[model samples]
Target: MKKTIYKKIHIIGSVGSGKTTLAKEISSLLGIPYYELDNVVWIRNKSGDIRRTEQEREEYLNSILQSDNWIIEGIHNEDWVSNCFQSADLIIFLDTNYLVRTYRIIKRFLKQKLRIEKANYKPTLDIFFKMFKWNRHFEEVGKVNFFNKYVVHKDKIKVINNAKCIKKYFN
Candidate 1:
Protein backbone atom coordinates (compact mmCIF):
# COMPACT_ATOMS: atom_id res chain seq x y z
CA MET A 1 0.00 0.00 0.00
CA LYS A 2 1.16 3.49 -0.80
CA LYS A 3 1.67 5.50 2.34
CA THR A 4 0.46 9.05 2.56
CA ILE A 5 3.26 11.56 2.94
CA TYR A 6 3.71 12.23 6.63
CA LYS A 7 3.51 15.53 8.40
CA LYS A 8 7.07 14.94 9.53
CA ILE A 9 9.60 13.74 7.00
CA HIS A 10 13.28 13.03 7.49
CA ILE A 11 15.73 12.85 4.65
CA ILE A 12 19.12 11.18 5.13
CA GLY A 13 21.94 10.65 2.69
CA SER A 14 25.67 10.98 2.24
CA VAL A 15 27.22 14.35 1.48
CA GLY A 16 26.27 15.77 -1.93
CA SER A 17 23.23 13.49 -2.23
CA GLY A 18 20.79 16.38 -2.89
CA LYS A 19 19.05 15.97 0.46
CA THR A 20 18.62 19.72 0.91
CA THR A 21 17.20 20.21 -2.53
CA LEU A 22 14.80 17.35 -2.16
CA ALA A 23 13.79 18.52 1.27
CA LYS A 24 12.95 21.92 -0.12
CA GLU A 25 10.92 20.43 -2.90
CA ILE A 26 9.03 18.10 -0.62
CA SER A 27 8.40 20.81 1.93
CA SER A 28 6.95 23.03 -0.75
CA LEU A 29 4.83 20.22 -2.05
CA LEU A 30 3.54 19.29 1.37
CA GLY A 31 3.28 22.84 2.61
CA ILE A 32 5.51 22.07 5.56
CA PRO A 33 8.50 23.87 7.03
CA TYR A 34 11.92 22.54 6.07
CA TYR A 35 15.04 22.62 8.22
CA GLU A 36 18.53 21.96 7.00
CA LEU A 37 20.76 20.55 9.70
CA ASP A 38 23.81 22.42 8.43
CA ASN A 39 22.02 25.72 8.95
CA VAL A 40 21.24 24.72 12.52
CA VAL A 41 24.82 23.61 13.11
CA TRP A 42 26.83 26.43 11.52
CA ILE A 43 26.76 30.14 12.10
CA ARG A 44 27.37 32.22 9.00
CA ASN A 45 30.59 34.22 8.90
CA LYS A 46 33.64 34.83 6.77
CA SER A 47 34.80 31.78 8.70
CA GLY A 48 31.89 29.67 9.84
CA ASP A 49 31.74 28.08 13.26
CA ILE A 50 29.70 25.37 14.88
CA ARG A 51 27.61 27.72 16.89
CA ARG A 52 25.49 25.54 19.18
CA THR A 53 26.41 23.59 22.25
CA GLU A 54 25.14 20.03 22.44
CA GLN A 55 22.35 21.08 24.75
CA GLU A 56 21.44 24.01 22.55
CA ARG A 57 21.40 21.82 19.47
CA GLU A 58 19.24 19.25 21.17
CA GLU A 59 16.82 21.90 22.37
CA TYR A 60 16.56 23.48 18.95
CA LEU A 61 15.97 20.13 17.29
CA ASN A 62 13.41 19.20 19.89
CA SER A 63 11.49 22.39 19.24
CA ILE A 64 11.39 21.74 15.53
CA LEU A 65 10.31 18.16 16.00
CA GLN A 66 7.55 19.34 18.27
CA SER A 67 6.03 21.30 15.41
CA ASP A 68 3.00 19.98 13.55
CA ASN A 69 4.75 19.66 10.23
CA TRP A 70 8.41 19.65 9.23
CA ILE A 71 11.07 18.21 6.98
CA ILE A 72 14.54 17.56 8.40
CA GLU A 73 17.41 16.98 6.03
CA GLY A 74 20.98 16.01 6.90
CA ILE A 75 23.81 13.53 6.65
CA HIS A 76 23.93 13.14 10.42
CA ASN A 77 23.03 9.67 11.65
CA GLU A 78 23.95 10.09 15.28
CA ASP A 79 21.80 9.20 18.26
CA TRP A 80 20.55 12.77 18.51
CA VAL A 81 19.10 12.53 15.00
CA SER A 82 17.66 9.09 15.53
CA ASN A 83 14.53 10.63 17.01
CA CYS A 84 13.84 12.19 13.62
CA PHE A 85 13.83 8.80 11.98
CA GLN A 86 11.80 7.19 14.73
CA SER A 87 9.13 9.87 14.53
CA ALA A 88 9.07 10.50 10.83
CA ASP A 89 6.14 9.34 8.72
CA LEU A 90 8.52 8.92 5.82
CA ILE A 91 12.29 8.56 5.70
CA ILE A 92 14.01 9.04 2.39
CA PHE A 93 17.48 7.74 1.78
CA LEU A 94 19.06 8.99 -1.40
CA ASP A 95 21.53 6.61 -2.99
CA THR A 96 22.39 8.33 -6.22
CA ASN A 97 25.52 7.24 -8.06
CA TYR A 98 28.85 8.54 -6.78
CA LEU A 99 29.72 10.34 -10.02
CA VAL A 100 26.28 11.90 -10.14
CA ARG A 101 26.46 13.12 -6.57
CA THR A 102 29.99 14.43 -7.19
CA TYR A 103 28.80 16.34 -10.23
CA ARG A 104 25.97 17.85 -8.24
CA ILE A 105 28.35 18.89 -5.48
CA ILE A 106 30.70 20.55 -7.95
CA LYS A 107 27.83 22.34 -9.61
CA ARG A 108 26.49 23.44 -6.26
CA PHE A 109 29.95 24.77 -5.31
CA LEU A 110 30.17 26.80 -8.49
CA LYS A 111 26.68 28.15 -7.97
CA GLN A 112 27.47 29.15 -4.41
CA LYS A 113 30.70 30.85 -5.51
CA LEU A 114 28.86 32.76 -8.19
CA ARG A 115 26.11 33.68 -5.77
CA ILE A 116 23.52 31.92 -7.89
CA GLU A 117 22.63 29.70 -4.98
CA LYS A 118 22.81 30.93 -1.43
CA ALA A 119 23.93 28.66 1.36
CA ASN A 120 23.91 29.34 5.09
CA TYR A 121 27.67 29.01 4.77
CA LYS A 122 30.18 29.36 1.98
CA PRO A 123 32.05 26.43 0.51
CA THR A 124 35.80 26.58 0.12
CA LEU A 125 37.69 24.39 -2.31
CA ASP A 126 39.15 22.60 0.69
CA ILE A 127 35.69 21.90 2.05
CA PHE A 128 34.56 20.86 -1.39
CA PHE A 129 37.39 18.35 -1.63
CA LYS A 130 36.64 17.08 1.83
CA MET A 131 33.00 16.58 0.90
CA PHE A 132 34.09 14.66 -2.16
CA LYS A 133 36.27 12.43 -0.04
CA TRP A 134 33.43 11.86 2.39
CA ASN A 135 31.02 11.03 -0.43
CA ARG A 136 33.45 8.53 -1.91
CA HIS A 137 34.04 6.93 1.44
CA PHE A 138 30.31 6.83 2.15
CA GLU A 139 29.72 4.91 -1.06
CA GLU A 140 32.49 2.47 -0.19
CA VAL A 141 31.50 1.76 3.39
CA GLY A 142 29.69 4.17 5.66
CA LYS A 143 26.24 4.43 4.07
CA VAL A 144 25.84 0.80 3.12
CA ASN A 145 27.00 -0.41 6.51
CA PHE A 146 24.69 1.98 8.29
CA PHE A 147 21.72 0.88 6.21
CA ASN A 148 22.47 -2.78 6.71
CA LYS A 149 22.89 -2.47 10.43
CA TYR A 150 20.17 0.07 11.25
CA VAL A 151 17.65 0.27 8.42
CA VAL A 152 16.78 -3.32 7.66
CA HIS A 153 13.06 -2.63 8.08
CA LYS A 154 11.64 -1.09 4.94
CA ASP A 155 8.14 -0.06 5.95
CA LYS A 156 8.99 3.65 5.87
CA ILE A 157 12.28 3.70 4.00
CA LYS A 158 12.40 4.96 0.44
CA VAL A 159 15.70 4.58 -1.35
CA ILE A 160 15.90 6.94 -4.29
CA ASN A 161 18.52 5.48 -6.59
CA ASN A 162 18.39 7.82 -9.57
CA ALA A 163 16.93 10.99 -11.05
CA LYS A 164 13.96 9.06 -12.40
CA CYS A 165 13.26 7.53 -9.03
CA ILE A 166 13.42 10.95 -7.45
CA LYS A 167 10.96 12.37 -9.95
CA LYS A 168 8.70 9.41 -9.42
CA TYR A 169 8.63 10.01 -5.72
CA PHE A 170 7.56 13.60 -6.21
CA ASN A 171 4.89 12.56 -8.64
Candidate 2:
Protein backbone atom coordinates (compact mmCIF):
# COMPACT_ATOMS: atom_id res chain seq x y z
CA MET A 1 0.00 0.00 0.00
CA LYS A 2 1.07 3.56 -0.59
CA LYS A 3 1.60 6.06 2.22
CA THR A 4 -1.57 6.53 4.25
CA ILE A 5 -3.16 9.92 3.76
CA TYR A 6 -5.64 9.20 6.49
CA LYS A 7 -3.80 8.82 9.76
CA LYS A 8 -6.86 8.39 11.97
CA ILE A 9 -9.97 6.64 10.74
CA HIS A 10 -13.09 5.92 12.79
CA ILE A 11 -15.77 3.53 11.56
CA ILE A 12 -19.25 3.25 13.12
CA GLY A 13 -22.07 0.84 12.35
CA SER A 14 -24.58 -1.52 13.92
CA VAL A 15 -24.25 -5.26 14.32
CA GLY A 16 -23.60 -7.07 11.04
CA SER A 17 -23.10 -3.73 9.33
CA GLY A 18 -19.59 -4.79 8.23
CA LYS A 19 -17.67 -2.36 10.46
CA THR A 20 -15.05 -4.94 11.29
CA THR A 21 -14.71 -6.08 7.72
CA LEU A 22 -14.35 -2.55 6.45
CA ALA A 23 -11.93 -1.56 9.21
CA LYS A 24 -9.74 -4.57 8.54
CA GLU A 25 -9.74 -3.90 4.82
CA ILE A 26 -8.77 -0.26 5.28
CA SER A 27 -6.15 -1.12 7.88
CA SER A 28 -4.61 -3.66 5.56
CA LEU A 29 -4.64 -1.36 2.58
CA LEU A 30 -3.39 1.69 4.48
CA GLY A 31 -1.01 -0.13 6.78
CA ILE A 32 -2.71 1.32 9.85
CA PRO A 33 -3.53 -0.65 13.00
CA TYR A 34 -7.18 -1.24 13.81
CA TYR A 35 -8.86 -1.53 17.21
CA GLU A 36 -12.28 -2.87 18.00
CA LEU A 37 -14.23 -1.08 20.71
CA ASP A 38 -15.35 -4.39 22.20
CA ASN A 39 -11.74 -5.37 22.79
CA VAL A 40 -11.21 -2.02 24.47
CA VAL A 41 -14.21 -2.67 26.70
CA TRP A 42 -13.20 -6.21 27.62
CA ILE A 43 -10.03 -7.92 28.76
CA ARG A 44 -9.79 -11.06 26.64
CA ASN A 45 -8.41 -14.05 28.52
CA LYS A 46 -8.34 -17.84 28.47
CA SER A 47 -11.08 -18.06 31.08
CA GLY A 48 -13.46 -15.50 29.58
CA ASP A 49 -13.68 -11.92 28.46
CA ILE A 50 -13.79 -9.68 31.54
CA ARG A 51 -15.56 -6.36 31.38
CA ARG A 52 -13.38 -3.32 31.80
CA THR A 53 -14.21 -0.63 34.32
CA GLU A 54 -15.64 2.59 32.91
CA GLN A 55 -12.44 4.39 33.81
CA GLU A 56 -10.34 1.68 32.24
CA ARG A 57 -12.35 1.73 29.03
CA GLU A 58 -12.02 5.49 28.76
CA GLU A 59 -8.31 5.40 29.48
CA TYR A 60 -7.74 2.64 26.95
CA LEU A 61 -9.62 4.54 24.26
CA ASN A 62 -7.72 7.72 25.06
CA SER A 63 -4.44 5.89 24.65
CA ILE A 64 -5.45 4.67 21.22
CA LEU A 65 -6.57 8.12 20.16
CA GLN A 66 -3.21 9.49 21.24
CA SER A 67 -1.52 7.43 18.55
CA ASP A 68 -0.50 8.95 15.21
CA ASN A 69 -2.32 6.38 13.15
CA TRP A 70 -5.22 4.07 13.92
CA ILE A 71 -8.46 2.63 12.60
CA ILE A 72 -11.13 2.45 15.32
CA GLU A 73 -14.41 0.72 14.59
CA GLY A 74 -17.48 0.18 16.77
CA ILE A 75 -21.21 0.67 17.14
CA HIS A 76 -20.74 3.07 20.06
CA ASN A 77 -21.79 6.68 19.45
CA GLU A 78 -21.98 7.74 23.08
CA ASP A 79 -20.25 10.81 24.52
CA TRP A 80 -17.28 8.76 25.66
CA VAL A 81 -16.45 7.94 22.04
CA SER A 82 -17.15 11.39 20.65
CA ASN A 83 -13.48 12.20 20.78
CA CYS A 84 -12.79 9.50 18.24
CA PHE A 85 -15.13 11.07 15.73
CA GLN A 86 -13.66 14.47 16.39
CA SER A 87 -10.08 13.33 16.06
CA ALA A 88 -10.50 11.14 13.02
CA ASP A 89 -9.02 12.21 9.73
CA LEU A 90 -11.80 10.22 8.16
CA ILE A 91 -15.03 8.90 9.69
CA ILE A 92 -17.02 6.18 7.93
CA PHE A 93 -20.63 5.40 8.78
CA LEU A 94 -21.51 2.06 7.29
CA ASP A 95 -25.18 2.77 6.67
CA THR A 96 -25.79 -0.68 5.27
CA ASN A 97 -29.32 -1.73 4.38
CA TYR A 98 -31.34 -2.95 7.35
CA LEU A 99 -32.36 -6.13 5.58
CA VAL A 100 -28.78 -6.82 4.54
CA ARG A 101 -27.61 -6.44 8.13
CA THR A 102 -30.28 -8.79 9.39
CA TYR A 103 -29.22 -11.42 6.89
CA ARG A 104 -25.59 -10.99 7.96
CA ILE A 105 -26.52 -11.45 11.62
CA ILE A 106 -28.10 -14.77 10.82
CA LYS A 107 -25.23 -15.82 8.60
CA ARG A 108 -22.58 -14.78 11.10
CA PHE A 109 -24.23 -16.64 13.95
CA LEU A 110 -24.43 -19.79 11.89
CA LYS A 111 -20.80 -19.48 10.82
CA GLN A 112 -19.61 -19.07 14.39
CA LYS A 113 -21.81 -21.86 15.68
CA LEU A 114 -20.42 -24.20 13.03
CA ARG A 115 -16.86 -23.20 13.89
CA ILE A 116 -16.36 -21.76 10.41
CA GLU A 117 -15.62 -18.35 11.83
CA LYS A 118 -13.79 -17.10 14.92
CA ALA A 119 -15.71 -15.00 17.42
CA ASN A 120 -14.57 -12.76 20.23
CA TYR A 121 -17.29 -14.20 22.46
CA LYS A 122 -19.03 -17.53 22.50
CA PRO A 123 -21.75 -17.91 19.91
CA THR A 124 -24.66 -18.76 22.11
CA LEU A 125 -28.32 -18.88 21.12
CA ASP A 126 -29.02 -16.02 23.52
CA ILE A 127 -26.33 -13.82 22.00
CA PHE A 128 -27.54 -14.68 18.52
CA PHE A 129 -31.05 -13.50 19.46
CA LYS A 130 -29.65 -10.37 21.11
CA MET A 131 -27.90 -9.41 17.87
CA PHE A 132 -31.29 -9.04 16.24
CA LYS A 133 -32.51 -6.71 19.01
CA TRP A 134 -29.31 -4.70 18.83
CA ASN A 135 -29.67 -4.41 15.06
CA ARG A 136 -33.17 -3.00 15.36
CA HIS A 137 -32.17 -0.59 18.12
CA PHE A 138 -29.32 0.72 16.02
CA GLU A 139 -31.61 1.31 13.05
CA GLU A 140 -34.17 3.14 15.19
CA VAL A 141 -31.98 5.06 17.63
CA GLY A 142 -28.22 4.67 17.25
CA LYS A 143 -28.13 5.77 13.61
CA VAL A 144 -29.87 9.04 14.36
CA ASN A 145 -27.75 9.70 17.45
CA PHE A 146 -24.58 9.10 15.44
CA PHE A 147 -25.55 11.65 12.81
CA ASN A 148 -26.56 14.32 15.33
CA LYS A 149 -23.44 13.92 17.42
CA TYR A 150 -21.05 13.98 14.49
CA VAL A 151 -22.82 16.46 12.23
CA VAL A 152 -20.11 18.98 13.01
CA HIS A 153 -17.65 16.64 11.33
CA LYS A 154 -19.86 15.93 8.35
CA ASP A 155 -17.28 17.06 5.81
CA LYS A 156 -14.98 14.20 6.74
CA ILE A 157 -17.71 11.63 7.30
CA LYS A 158 -18.37 9.19 4.48
CA VAL A 159 -21.74 7.48 4.61
CA ILE A 160 -21.02 4.25 2.78
CA ASN A 161 -22.74 0.93 2.33
CA ASN A 162 -19.65 -0.86 1.06
CA ALA A 163 -15.89 -0.77 1.42
CA LYS A 164 -15.50 -0.63 -2.35
CA CYS A 165 -16.61 2.98 -2.35
CA ILE A 166 -14.02 3.80 0.28
CA LYS A 167 -11.28 2.14 -1.73
CA LYS A 168 -12.19 4.15 -4.79
CA TYR A 169 -12.44 7.44 -2.92
CA PHE A 170 -9.40 7.11 -0.69
CA ASN A 171 -7.13 5.64 -3.30
Candidate 3:
Protein backbone atom coordinates (compact mmCIF):
# COMPACT_ATOMS: atom_id res chain seq x y z
CA MET A 1 0.00 0.00 0.00
CA LYS A 2 1.06 3.55 -0.67
CA LYS A 3 1.25 6.22 1.99
CA THR A 4 -0.21 9.69 1.69
CA ILE A 5 2.20 12.58 1.40
CA TYR A 6 1.71 14.79 4.43
CA LYS A 7 3.11 18.29 4.14
CA LYS A 8 1.68 19.70 7.34
CA ILE A 9 1.41 17.58 10.47
CA HIS A 10 0.24 18.58 13.94
CA ILE A 11 1.22 16.16 16.70
CA ILE A 12 -0.65 16.44 19.99
CA GLY A 13 -0.08 14.61 23.26
CA SER A 14 0.61 14.99 26.96
CA VAL A 15 4.08 15.61 28.42
CA GLY A 16 6.56 12.80 27.61
CA SER A 17 4.37 11.57 24.78
CA GLY A 18 7.25 11.38 22.32
CA LYS A 19 5.86 14.19 20.17
CA THR A 20 9.19 15.99 19.91
CA THR A 21 11.13 12.84 19.16
CA LEU A 22 8.69 11.82 16.45
CA ALA A 23 8.60 15.31 14.96
CA LYS A 24 12.36 15.37 14.67
CA GLU A 25 12.49 11.95 13.02
CA ILE A 26 9.88 12.85 10.43
CA SER A 27 11.41 16.23 9.74
CA SER A 28 14.86 14.70 9.26
CA LEU A 29 13.54 11.87 7.08
CA LEU A 30 11.37 14.05 4.85
CA GLY A 31 13.58 17.11 4.90
CA ILE A 32 10.77 19.22 6.30
CA PRO A 33 11.27 21.70 9.12
CA TYR A 34 9.52 20.95 12.40
CA TYR A 35 8.39 23.39 15.06
CA GLU A 36 7.55 23.12 18.72
CA LEU A 37 4.42 25.11 19.56
CA ASP A 38 5.89 26.03 22.95
CA ASN A 39 8.58 27.97 21.10
CA VAL A 40 5.85 29.96 19.38
CA VAL A 41 4.29 30.94 22.71
CA TRP A 42 7.52 31.87 24.51
CA ILE A 43 10.62 33.88 23.78
CA ARG A 44 13.47 31.82 25.17
CA ASN A 45 16.40 33.80 26.49
CA LYS A 46 19.37 32.99 28.68
CA SER A 47 18.15 35.37 31.33
CA GLY A 48 14.59 34.04 31.51
CA ASP A 49 11.68 32.97 29.33
CA ILE A 50 9.02 35.51 28.39
CA ARG A 51 5.51 34.78 27.21
CA ARG A 52 4.55 36.24 23.84
CA THR A 53 1.52 38.43 23.49
CA GLU A 54 -1.53 36.78 21.99
CA GLN A 55 -1.18 38.75 18.77
CA GLU A 56 2.47 37.85 18.49
CA ARG A 57 1.79 34.18 19.08
CA GLU A 58 -1.00 34.17 16.54
CA GLU A 59 1.16 35.86 13.94
CA TYR A 60 4.02 33.45 14.55
CA LEU A 61 1.78 30.42 14.13
CA ASN A 62 0.16 31.92 11.06
CA SER A 63 3.52 32.36 9.42
CA ILE A 64 4.31 28.67 9.88
CA LEU A 65 0.86 27.58 8.67
CA GLN A 66 1.31 29.65 5.54
CA SER A 67 4.49 27.78 4.74
CA ASP A 68 4.79 24.86 2.31
CA ASN A 69 5.50 22.14 4.85
CA TRP A 70 6.00 21.76 8.60
CA ILE A 71 5.63 19.37 11.50
CA ILE A 72 4.30 21.02 14.69
CA GLU A 73 4.38 19.19 18.00
CA GLY A 74 2.94 20.34 21.31
CA ILE A 75 0.54 19.53 24.13
CA HIS A 76 -1.55 22.67 23.62
CA ASN A 77 -5.20 22.02 22.79
CA GLU A 78 -6.51 25.47 23.44
CA ASP A 79 -8.67 27.53 21.06
CA TRP A 80 -5.62 29.52 20.03
CA VAL A 81 -4.17 26.30 18.55
CA SER A 82 -7.31 25.22 16.71
CA ASN A 83 -6.11 26.63 13.44
CA CYS A 84 -3.14 24.28 13.55
CA PHE A 85 -5.46 21.27 13.57
CA GLN A 86 -7.56 22.75 10.79
CA SER A 87 -4.58 23.47 8.56
CA ALA A 88 -2.70 20.24 9.10
CA ASP A 89 -2.80 17.48 6.51
CA LEU A 90 -2.27 14.98 9.31
CA ILE A 91 -3.09 15.15 13.01
CA ILE A 92 -1.21 12.67 15.17
CA PHE A 93 -2.63 12.00 18.60
CA LEU A 94 0.07 10.23 20.55
CA ASP A 95 -1.97 8.16 22.97
CA THR A 96 1.03 6.79 24.74
CA ASN A 97 0.27 4.46 27.65
CA TYR A 98 -0.25 6.11 31.02
CA LEU A 99 2.39 3.99 32.74
CA VAL A 100 4.83 4.73 29.94
CA ARG A 101 4.21 8.44 30.20
CA THR A 102 4.75 8.26 33.95
CA TYR A 103 8.05 6.51 33.47
CA ARG A 104 9.20 9.01 30.89
CA ILE A 105 8.28 11.89 33.17
CA ILE A 106 10.48 10.48 35.93
CA LYS A 107 13.32 9.63 33.60
CA ARG A 108 13.22 13.01 31.87
CA PHE A 109 13.37 14.87 35.16
CA LEU A 110 16.37 12.88 36.28
CA LYS A 111 18.15 13.48 32.98
CA GLN A 112 17.44 17.20 33.11
CA LYS A 113 18.62 17.41 36.71
CA LEU A 114 21.80 15.60 35.84
CA ARG A 115 22.42 17.80 32.78
CA ILE A 116 22.08 14.74 30.57
CA GLU A 117 19.10 16.34 28.86
CA LYS A 118 18.72 19.97 27.79
CA ALA A 119 15.32 21.37 28.69
CA ASN A 120 13.49 24.22 27.05
CA TYR A 121 12.59 25.60 30.44
CA LYS A 122 14.35 25.42 33.77
CA PRO A 123 13.77 21.98 35.27
CA THR A 124 12.66 22.98 38.70
CA LEU A 125 10.92 20.96 41.40
CA ASP A 126 7.64 22.75 40.77
CA ILE A 127 7.77 21.91 37.08
CA PHE A 128 8.63 18.31 37.88
CA PHE A 129 5.55 17.96 40.07
CA LYS A 130 3.40 19.63 37.44
CA MET A 131 4.39 17.07 34.86
CA PHE A 132 2.71 14.34 36.87
CA LYS A 133 -0.40 16.46 37.25
CA TRP A 134 -0.40 17.15 33.54
CA ASN A 135 -0.09 13.48 32.76
CA ARG A 136 -3.00 12.58 35.01
CA HIS A 137 -5.15 15.43 33.70
CA PHE A 138 -4.42 14.39 30.16
CA GLU A 139 -5.56 10.86 30.85
CA GLU A 140 -8.67 12.05 32.66
CA VAL A 141 -9.60 15.08 30.61
CA GLY A 142 -7.37 16.03 27.70
CA LYS A 143 -7.85 12.83 25.74
CA VAL A 144 -11.62 13.10 25.88
CA ASN A 145 -11.51 16.82 25.20
CA PHE A 146 -9.42 16.37 22.08
CA PHE A 147 -11.71 13.72 20.63
CA ASN A 148 -14.85 15.70 21.42
CA LYS A 149 -13.62 18.99 20.03
CA TYR A 150 -11.66 17.76 17.03
CA VAL A 151 -14.10 15.10 15.89
CA VAL A 152 -14.66 17.07 12.73
CA HIS A 153 -11.11 16.29 11.71
CA LYS A 154 -11.41 12.58 12.43
CA ASP A 155 -10.61 11.64 8.87
CA LYS A 156 -7.10 13.00 9.20
CA ILE A 157 -6.42 12.02 12.78
CA LYS A 158 -4.18 9.08 13.65
CA VAL A 159 -4.09 7.65 17.15
CA ILE A 160 -0.71 6.09 17.85
CA ASN A 161 -0.44 4.16 21.06
CA ASN A 162 2.76 2.36 20.29
CA ALA A 163 6.17 3.64 19.23
CA LYS A 164 6.93 0.63 17.09
CA CYS A 165 3.94 1.37 14.87
CA ILE A 166 5.56 4.62 13.77
CA LYS A 167 8.26 2.91 11.75
CA LYS A 168 5.73 1.60 9.24
CA TYR A 169 4.74 5.11 8.25
CA PHE A 170 8.28 6.20 7.52
CA ASN A 171 9.10 3.02 5.67
Q: Give TM per candidate.
A: 0.88, 0.95, 0.97
Ranking by TM-score: 3, 2, 1
Ranking by lDDT: 3, 2, 1
Candidate 3 lDDT by residue in tens digits, 108-161: 999999999999999999999999999999999999999999999999998999
Tens digit of per-residue lDDT, candidate 1, span 1-171: 785557988888888888888888887877999998876666557656668888888888999999998999988777777788888888888887888888888998999999998867667888889988889888888787658755744688888875467666667
Error of 3 at 72 (Å): 0.3
Worst 10 residues of 3 by lDDT: 162-171
Q: Which consecutive 10 residues in model 1 have the weakest lDDT in total? A: 145-154
Question: Which is the winner by lDDT between candidate 1 and candidate 3?
Answer: 3
Q: Give residue 55's lDDT in candidate 2 (0 to 100).
A: 99
Better of 1 and 2 by TM-score: 2
Off by over 4 Å in 1: 1-3, 45-47, 167-170
Candidate 2 residue 56 Cα shift, in angstroms, is 0.6
Residue-wise lDDT of candidate 2 within 84-140, one digit each (tens)?
999999999999999999999999999998999999998899999999999999999
